[model samples]
Target: MLPLQIGSFTPKAPVVLAPMAGVTNRAFRAMCRSYGDELVYVNEMVMSHAVVYRNDKTLTMMQFGDDESPRSLQIYGSDPDMLGRAVHQVCDEGRVDHVDLNFGCPAAKVTRKGGGAAVPAKPKLLQQIVRRAVQAAEPYGVPVTAKFRMGLWDDLRTDITTGRICADEGIGWIALHARTVEQHYSGEARWEAIGALKEAVTDIPVLGNGDIWEASDAVAMMAQTDCDGVVIGRGCLGRPWLFGDLITVLNGGEAPAPRRLGEVAEAMRRHARLLTDHYAGFGGEEHAMRDFRKHCAWYLSGYPVGPDVRRTLAQVSSLAQLDDVLGAFDPDAEIVEGGERIKRGHTNGPIKVALPEGYLDDPDELAIPDDADVMALSGG
Candidate 1:
């Protein structure tokens, strides 16, 4: 029982799928959940502003497979009223089992507007956002959780403080991505910060994120920090089956054996099918085929393939092309041991944090500009 409980919801495996910007859609989540019976899959973070207005694209992005029980969605916004309205809107639609606030995002488009990780820098503003969201979801029994990074920058980290604040605001659970905006996804994650947060906050579950590239790493993190649960972000990319392995480990078994190329290739095909089926009207196979090109690098990573195969897969624009790409591989080949250690996703960081003037000078400033909401078509 790691991050085992949250109110009445007790995830059997307690392995959470962290929400990515453009990833983790309905199609992707269903595939991941299908791999593990108890996996908790979070939809990609959606800007509350978009949800409040009932943006078709945002609403579509929030879709979950019928079987995706305990469906989780991450909401990003800075306004209390708008955020509250957004929370209720999602719950009223009866589509969400959980709502996780996005205070951890370090994207420049988000931070520059005093949202995301920048919101935590202003405790009062963060409190407003969380309080309103929790209140809005209370009537619907939608458990509200929160996921965030360490802080805006290294010199100004605020993980422990934010943990206390979120716990105080009644967030059912909290996840900390043990790195700061400055570090982004570049430097090695500092698990020590996760331990510090676990020590500082005792009222609610403290789930640790970042640096968990393998199942054994999750075990080591739990042993090292005593955190309640492990929230996986990049580790599951192109390998939704990672959740299956996580389930085995949480159940006192070992992670699964190295995957055969055939198994991986088949999963890729299934993922493409799921995407096409779910996005039926949104370009159908044509859209799915193009969208899935991005996942090719992740799915077939480290496998032996020539430039021609790679190039062909790089711009896969149709199902026939996708089939050809998969056909070029030796499906029976095995993943070299520990190949998962290779890093992927948002690796650039330690860069200057974009922020409003004096955003860090006052923690009491609760007035986020009407413009601070992520309000983007993609990602926070």
Candidate 2:
């Protein structure tokens, strides 16, 4: 396997944790890293304006654990100047070693404003944002990277051009999600596009994203696409240990055996405890446990646990409640048939991309959509 090099930093493993909005916070990153700390685990995506304006919550979200190394952060926005300021602030302050620009978000709330996945449609504007971001980080010697979808939709493809622009702008590396904005998270990701992008962007490493649901999927993606590395997204939702599995398989070993229900429960407890500690300064354990309610479903997705237990766990607001609910389950039970392949997040798609009127009129013209700002939305 080829090692991944982002600037002067080379990860012990050629894997990266894709920055998911509400999912990839400090606790989750640490949880994933506990399984394997050598890979790049990016903090959740923050709006560039939030960083520039010093939004308290956003700034706090950027915090890293003491042991976190090669700290990576992802930011998104439409205005080059604002992104530049945000990148400059983080880089100058030594807050992050790697800064990733987000251009692949497909949410209607993002694209309607000509941000996220919509930004790639306007080649000139995309270039400006990437260029300014790279320029902002260059002086600090912090690497700048970008991730984007294949295009707005099937009819309008911009990944090749986007890759070229990012490479020319001095981006340290680029990741292709391999799904169009319209496709959202539905359907199969086009791995062939990753192969194409890797061929087109020879100067920098190209990482592949989308549909990496298991450790074997990661190995298969690298073998098929010849990408420099694999970015794990929805695959690691309930399975942080997937990182460990990836390390094993990528290093020429077989994946570990399936875990029992008790083991999964143990992981859940650890995750909950980590979240509680992360939010200790803000809302303490109660708030943290409440925030963890969503993860209950992800963790129990493939388990044969009864509906009553699932419902109870989903609403658990304290560590005591979590333990009580999990304790009722049989520890020896294993995952249901085909449970590992079950998708966890943003599974619906193929909807019309919400773009500003005439947003696609001129790909060469540099422009910003009306009513778009960094604070309007968060994450990709």
Candidate 3:
């Protein structure tokens, strides 16, 4: 396989961890990075306004480990100016290596405000935002990339045009999820879109995302679309080690054998511990453990545990309680199959996506309404 170059940084492997809100925090990213080298891990999408205004949580989300390679950040905004400013801040800080714009989000709140998937419908605004972000990062030598869906709705196809514009603006890469905003996450991702995108742009790499549940799926995506790389999203939800599997397959080796329950439990403990350490200054282990409750199901989805066990695990408020509940599990149990591919987050029905009035009227210029400045409530 060919190496992926973004600015001066070249990743030996083309695999990347797609940024997902509430899931791709420092602890989770660190866990996944341990399984693969040269795999770029993106921070959760941060609202541009939040970044510019120094929202405490948003700033914290951008924090990366000192040894993290190719620190990547993803920003979401509908306005070109705010997005540009956020990119400039990232560049000026000299902390991040790559920046990815978010146009693939399908949350109702985000679409209602002319953001996320809605932004891509206005080709002009999309181009301006990409251009401004790239220009902002040019001086710092940070490569800028963008991720988008196939289009606003199933009936309104726009990803091909939007992708070409991104390439024209000198984006380092373009990631296509192969689903429209209307389709949301319900149906299958159209691999055909990725194949078409590769044909549309020749200079930059096109990373295909969506529906890659296993290491073999990555290989299949590459073969079917001829894409440069694959971005694993819902596929790696409960299994961060999927990255390890991806590396193995990409190098012509078979994927490592499935992880046993005991091994997975150990990983879960480590993830919880890391979360404690990350938020220790603010809330201590108890608070951090409380926050980790949300991931209990995702981490232990396919296990043979009963409802009583799961309830206890979910209600854990402290590290000690967490340990007790985890200890009750038979760690030696066989790892169950098919649990790795279960959707873990953001499974919602498709609703009418929101956009600024007349957003689609002129597809060639930025048309950010003042109301669009605020980040949508649901998308983040």
Residue pairs clashing in model 3 are: 111-354, 124-364, 124-365
lDDT tens digits by residue: candidate 1, 301-376: 7676677887888888987778877877787897776678777666777778889878767779776745434555
TM, every model:
0.96, 0.96, 0.94
RMSD of 1: 1.7
lDDT of each: 0.82, 0.86, 0.81
Residue 182 in model 2: shift from native, Å?
Answer: 0.5
RMSD of 3: 1.9
Worst 10 residues of 3 by lDDT: 371-380
Badly placed stretches (over 4 Å) of model 2 are: 370-378
TM-score of 2: 0.96
State how far residue 38 of model 2 sits from its true place (Å): 0.7
Candidate 2 C-alpha lDDT tens digits along 1-380? 34566557788678999999878989999899999877899988898778888888787688888888889999887888888999999999988889988888777777887878888888888888988998899898888888888998889999999999998999888999998888888899999999999988898889999999888999889989999998999889888999999989888989998778898899999999999988877788898888798788888889898888877777788998898888888999999887988989788878898988887787777776542354534355
Where does candidate 1 clash, by residue pair? 2-228, 3-228, 3-229, 104-148, 104-149, 182-350, 262-331
